[model samples]
Target: MKILITGGAGFIGSNFIHYWMKKYSQDEIVNLDKLTYAGNLSNLRIVENLPNYHFIKGDITDKKLLEKLFKKENFDLIVHFAAESHVDRSITDPDIFLKTNILGTHNLLCMALKNRTRFHHVSTDEVFGSLKKNDPAFNEKTPYDPRSPYSASKAASDHLVRAYFHTYELPITISNCSNNYGPFHFPEKLFPLFITNLLENKKIPLYGDGEAVRDWLYVEDHCRAIDTIIKKGKIGETYCIGGNSEKSNKEVTYKILALLDKNEKMIEFVKDRPGHDQRYAIDFSKIKNELGWEPSVSFEDGIKKTIDWFSTNKAWWKSIKNGKYKEYYDKQYANH
Candidate 1:
C-alpha cells in the first residue's frame, strides 16, 4: 500500500513510520512534515535511505500543496498525525493550534474525500477532558469535554472527521490514545523534559503540586494498535488505545527520579498551566475485543527504555536545546 503520513517526522508519527517499514517490505510511505520545533528529521534517520520512503517538507494547512501532492502520489491510505500538540504552547498561542488542528485537519479530510482514500486520524484522549474523581475512564463513546485549547481544537477536528464520515461517506477510522512516552520524544513533553532535566542536573518543574493524572502508553504499542485498527477496524468507528498505566504527574516525576537514582530535591513546584486537566484515562475494550490488540510493554519496562534512550542520545536533544528550542525555553521559563 502507498501511505501518506502527515507530521511523519514528529514523535509518534516517526515511530509509526519505523514500525511500518519494518513490518511491510513492499509498502511505500510518504512523509509530510512541517518541521515544527518538535518535528525533527533526526528521528527518522533509520529510514531516510529506504527506497520506499519519501519525505515532503510542508504544512498541512497548505491546501494547494496537499492537493498537488495528493494528485501526484495518488496515495491509497492516509495516517493523519499532524497537529500542534503542546498544551502550554496552545495556551500561549491558541491561534496556531486552531489553525493547525481544526482547519488543517479539515483540509486533510477534504483532500482525502476528494481523492477517495482511506483516512485514519490519530487523536488524543484529552478530547474527552478531565475525569472527575468518581468518573469512569473515557471510551470510544465518551462525549468531548475538552478543557484546553489544544484539546478543544482536537475535539473540533474529531467532530469534523465524524461529520465527513457520515455526510460524505468518507472511509475513515479514528483512534483516541492516551499519553505516549518512548524514544525520540521531544523534550518539551513531560517525560522527556524530566528525563533531560535530570541528565543536566537541572530542577524538574512540577506544575501545581503535580497531582494531574494521565494514562501512559508506550509509543510502539500505540503504533501497533493503530496498525491493527487500520488493517481490520470497521469504518466510521473510533477506537480508544491506552496502556492501562495511570499515574499522576507527581508519581511519574518521582518514579523517573528513583529510576535514575536522583533525589526528590530535583523537583520544584511551579504555577499550574491554564485549564490543566486534573486527570485523564481511557477504556480500550473496543480495540481489544474487535482487533485483539492490547499494549504489550509494561510501564516499568517502557519507562526504563525511554530513560535509557534519552540518556544516551544526548546529542539528538542537546542540538535542539542549543538551537531552535532555546528561544521557546527562554520565553516560557523566564519567570521560573
Candidate 2:
C-alpha cells in the first residue's frame, strides 16, 4: 500500500511511521509535515534513507500543495496527524489552531474524498472535556465539550471526518486517544518537558495543585492501535485507545523525579493555563475487543525508558530546548 502520513515528523506521527514501516516492509510511505517547532526531521533520522520512505516539507493548510501531492502519489491510505496541538500555544494564538485543525482537516477530507482513499483521523480525548472524579472513561459515543481552542479544533475536525463518512460515504476511521508519552516527543508536552527540564537540572513546572488527571499511553502502543484500525477497522467507526494508566499531574512529576533521582524541591507549582481540563480518560474497549490491541508498556517502565531516552539523547533535546523554547518558558513560568 502507498501511504501518506501527515505530521510524520511530530512525536506520535514519527513513532507511527517507524511502527508501520517495520510491520509493512513493502508499503511505500510519504510523510508530509510543516516542520513546525514540534515537528523535527531529526525524529525520522533513522528511517530517512529507507527506499520505502519519503518526506515532504509542507503545511496541511496549503490546499494547492495537498492537491499536487494527491495527484502525484495517488495515495491509498492517509493517516492525518497534522495539527496545532499544544494547549498553551492554542491559548496564546487560537487563529492558527482554527486554520490548521479545522480548515486543514477540511482540505484533507476533500482530497481523500476525491481520491477515494482510506482516511484515518488521529484525535484526542480532550475533545470530551473534563471528567468528574468518579466519571466513567470517555468512549467513542462521548459528547464533545471542548474546553480549549486546541480541543475545540480537534473536535470540529473529528466531526468533519464523521460527516464525510456518513454523508459522502468516505472510507474513514477516527481514533480518540489518551495522552501519549514516549521517544521523539518534543519537550513542549508535559512528559518530555518534565524529563528534559529535570535532566538539565532546571525547575519542573507543575500546574495549579497538580491534581489534574490524565490517562497516559505509550506512543508505540498508540501507533500499533492506529495500524490495526487502518488495516482492519470498519469504515465509519470510531475507536478509542489508551494505556489504561491514570496519573495525577503531581504523581507523574514525582514519578519522573524518582526515576531521575531528582529532588522534589525542583517541582515548582505554576499557574494553570486557561481552560485547563481537570481529567481525561479513555474507554478503549472497542479497539481492544475489535482489533486485539492493548498497551504493553507499563507506566513505570515507560517513564523510565523515556527518562533514559532524554538522558542519553541530550544533544537531541538540548538542541530543541534552547533558543525560542527558553524565551517561551521564561514568559510562561516567569510569574510562577
Candidate 2 ranges with C-alpha deviation above 4 Å: none
lDDT by residue for model 1 (174-226), tens: 99999999998998889999999899999988999898999999999999999
**lDDT tens per residue, model 2, 138-233:** 998888999999999999999999999999999999999999999998888899999998877888888999999999998998998998898889
* Candidate 2 pairs with clashing backbones: none
Assess the local accuracy of residue 194 in candidate 1 as a C-alpha lDDT between 0 and 100.
Answer: 94
Worst 10 residues of 2 by lDDT: 327-336
Model 1 score (lDDT): 0.93
Candidate lDDT values, in order: 0.93, 0.92
Model 1, TM vs. native: 0.98
